[model samples]
Target: MTELRDVDFFRDPNSVVSPYSYMDDLVQNSPVWIEPNYGVAMVAGYDEALTVMRETETYSAAPMIAGPTPDYGVEFTGDDIDEQLDAVRHRLPFNDQIVAMDPPQHTMRRALIMGLITPKRLKENEDFIWQLTDRQLDVVLPRGGCELVDDYAQPYALLVVADLLGVPEEDHPMLLEKAGVAANGSLTDTTKEPPKKHGGLEHFYEYFTDRVESRRREPKDDVLGRMAHATFPDGTLPEPLEAARIASNLFAAGQETTVRLLATALQIVGDDQGLQQKLRQDRGLIPKFIEEVLRWQGPIKGNMRVARKTTTLGGVHLKAGTQVFVMHGAAGRDPRQFDDPQGFDIERPNVRRHIAFGHGIHTCPGAPLARSEVRVTLERLLDRTSAIRISEAHHGPPDARRYDYLPSYMFRGLTKLHLEFDMEA
Candidate 1:
């Protein structure tokens, strides 16, 4: 077994920037070892992670983010897990968010969310993706070099999601400002400090409440309008706060993950000229390339699930309420599942099997939209750029490059990607 004291996977600054080296070690030595540092079970094996995800009855998706365990102030020596969960949830700020709920509650809320992003809706939004991509590119095309994350990926993602959610043009700045801060301190951040109530939720709450009220008064033909008047499976409209929570969850969750995906994809292509040229030459490979990127450098590092009952995972006995970190990043490169798992091969078969967007019922609902955004963005980028390369001054040479990833155990993305590209004449 690997020593937990040797590597602080959660709080270590280096883990935020580059965790694959550490993950590779963990997967090899201790696929199911409990890290004494955080006192949480780390599930690193590909099959083990999937088992935890698929068996939702045994694993609860509550407390999707890692933080200090909430104190309900009562010691329960009872067999009723449901009662214990209810008591603990009462203290969590995001208890009502769809991702934090288990069946029955999650079922209805997820239904309402699915109602908003139907195929037709996503297809319609797909058309807007090109326009949005080009508009952002126009801003950076004149400049030969730009920081990809701030100048392009971040704003582009925020705009696309804002447009999809029917956020007004005037409110764009506020949404960006508030959501940017909240995205960093998301449930995935591994700091030991107690999780504070996110301000972005408050921002979205007010914004969506007004929008929902407006839609109720005068309906329109947009996603917000659909969500504003959406009903549960039982034909009852969600409560005002519930409606706001749905919108807020969509807004925050959708943008955060997509931004990371875009930045990571761009960084990969930017750093490898030969691969960039190959992708540029054969546009058909864009989808496959995107899939490989998700497998190799997916934005989500892991997701947390609590054990709902006593269960054995990877031969380790887990009691109810134990937190499990399904290491998606590690699982993608598990040699048992994929041959040459470390290589970034776009043509690799089974690349789509990666759980970057997660798996089972809690799989990200905005995945389709995220995929579309990445595809359109890559297509337009190759169309407009003659050559795209990483800025060596910002990140060092190929032998020793310096890239800083987001400081969160749950997310894997560079904080900034500086690139120099020549626009096609």
Candidate 2:
């Protein structure tokens, strides 16, 4: 473990293991601390993060994948280099995905993909999720315990998203085997040299691409067929590959968000008998509990953004093309935005205002799905189990417990969660 003052958020695994302390140190110093190692302005305050998110013209998402020193593949020396970055956008990682593009294109594509998650579709998906969660528990509950992450959350979330996207039933196994969430640590790896290939949706990209093409050949009235011929708000049709990227991204993101969130929820519920009893008795508290979980420790630790031009935020100057790591987890814990910010309060009066889902146009589209998935899963778990206990064999005793976390600065989640549950009498 490196010194708190010298920790490299990108390179050091320790940062991923226990980032809260490091984040606390960073936010204490300033809302926007310029890391000397990478020259990244770590934006850890809520207000500063909002400025960076809202001022899209001033901070381009083009550098969303900056690994230490992101090579936008071009150089410029001026007050505004927005156009220069745009010209070399193809050379950047995730360039084709909605997360990387700037305005106009981003706005149009966002409008197009927004159709995938209509209120009607979400309601239908939630019904399926409740059934799936029971089916999952049926497999492990009889055994008296399970590793929630792999045994339950992972496959449960995968199938839910598959059903949502109308992925053929037969394809679920292939996705289960191949479409595992690519770890965020591998993306911003500083130890590796430049030009490393990014781990994308893997075969899912090609599979979806072929699905779109087949729909084009013989149209069927399903989600795939509609998306294959879907158009941007301006009536511009997207190519098959372009459309496939959106599908695969949604699939990957939905699974990852649900799995991480479920593990986090269980981790807390397993030990806090008082909290579990509260949630079980007053089931309405589940939504507030989920928001509190997000505020307490979001699935993503933070995300990186870049300055598109010269700008000032939180009273600090940023030059053109400067990279900023927007600390979402830190922002939630900022005392300025949240009173007793570090405390977990399910009844937080303004809990809905938290920026855990991010802000502005780039806010996570799967927020609703993730919330429902967890709420349903937790409700079912509580329904079936009279008591849930953290496996001391795996995690030690309550006061001096040990837990393993995912090794990625971009994602915050327990790697595994072992729970011993007593079946309902």
Candidate 3:
């Protein structure tokens, strides 16, 4: 049997997605394989992925990326990946962002955020979510055909996050533009330079810093306002810079992930009228559909962690400091995990088991918010549109479309998505 190498997977995520045919072989042959160049283990099987996630003691989130810091700059090397990840675990800027920490710290931070996402808050946001969805649809629905990425998905995702964070409606337009630019600014290619990379981390820091200052002076009911006054169990709160980082993370990750999810779902349902009608007729199935869409086309491609000690994964020996990427997208489609994994069946029973939001301690803190956003937005679209179809301007089968996914190996999302739909009948 041919041994699967992790280097190939990291260097070429696009090839791993398709009829390229090598993926299945790689998965079956060596679900936990090593990347020759990066010295990272590629974990693709569902069970193994879960193992990596849950075993926090042996594995660390330290090697999550190769960046020093978002604003100042942090060079992420194999060594720094492990060290830096460990260092940032407890430094929650405002309250407990939770995602950056481990163990007891992670638990405490998570509890605080979870309290905010209670059923009451979700219910309260129901009408608001639909209103935002409608605003997005109103613009795109009139166009009849437009790139779904910018026209619909981008706004939909940002608005959803904004609603939860209590961002002002007036700031929506500027925030959306900045978020998009930041998403596209990940490239390092000098030849064929991108349209614009001028205003990214700089602009983001300025925006969040200003927002943080405003919240400090005049507290409101939104997340920003809450963070401004939040205190840990010890009665201490994050410093100014830390608070800004938390907000920056929420803005960047929230907008990008949801945009990808929305685009993926539209592409899937738009390709099949029967599926669209099924969802439209029985809105009850919308939640289940959302779960499946997450399973089939999860936004995050993978996340990096480091082995804290020597270990053997997938029969391959991994020495200490070896970086491992928990391949969520690959594992979601793993044949071992779900039957007919390649097909997008909304009614799939195992949909809930999907690791799109991740597993164990580091599961996304904003999951409740994401679930609510997709469910409400999709249901409202079905309520408003008579028929939904892909814009001919963009061509491809549901899964084969070329997603201008960010260059980063960590987060996966499209740069643009073109879609079309009919007016209400």
- Winner of 1 and 3 under lDDT: 1
Deviation from native of the Cα of residue 247 in model 1, angstroms? 1.4
* Better model by TM-score: candidate 1 vs candidate 2: 2
- Give the alpha carbon lDDT tens digit for every residue of 1-425 in model 2: 14776878887887777888888776766888888798899998888888888988888887675565777766666889877887887887787778777789889877877888788878888888888888888988998988888788778877887888778777877666565432211122234434424444656678889999999999999978888888888888888888888877676567666789889999999889999999989999999999999988889777778887888888889888788899888888888878888788999987787788788988887889899999998898899999999999999999988899887777889989999989999
Show pairs that collide, candidate 2. none
Order the candidates by lDDT, highest first.
Answer: 2, 1, 3
Instruction: Say which candidate scores most in lDDT.
Output: 2
State every prediction's TM-score relative to the real structure: 0.92, 0.93, 0.81
Candidate 1 lDDT over residue span 1-425, tens digit each: 24443787878887887789878877776778677776678888889999988887888777677442435455434333666876677565467688878888988988888887777877777888899888888888788978877777777777677777777777777776655532222222325544447524777787888889889999998777887889999999987778988877776687778988988898889888899999989999999999999999898999787777877899998877777888999999899888898898999988999998888888998888889999998999899989988899999998889988788988888788888889898
Q: What lDDT does candidate 2 reach at residue 108?
A: 82
- Tens-digit lDDT track for model 3 on 274-360? 989998889898889889988877887687776766777767887766668888877888888789887878778878999998988
Residue 114 in model 1: lDDT: 83
Task: Write down the worst ten-residue block by lDDT for model 2.
Answer: 181-190
Cα lDDT of all candidates, in order? 0.80, 0.81, 0.66
Estimate candidate 1's RMSD in Å.
Answer: 3.9
Error of 2 at 25 (Å): 3.2
Cα distance off (Å), candidate 2, residue 41: 0.4
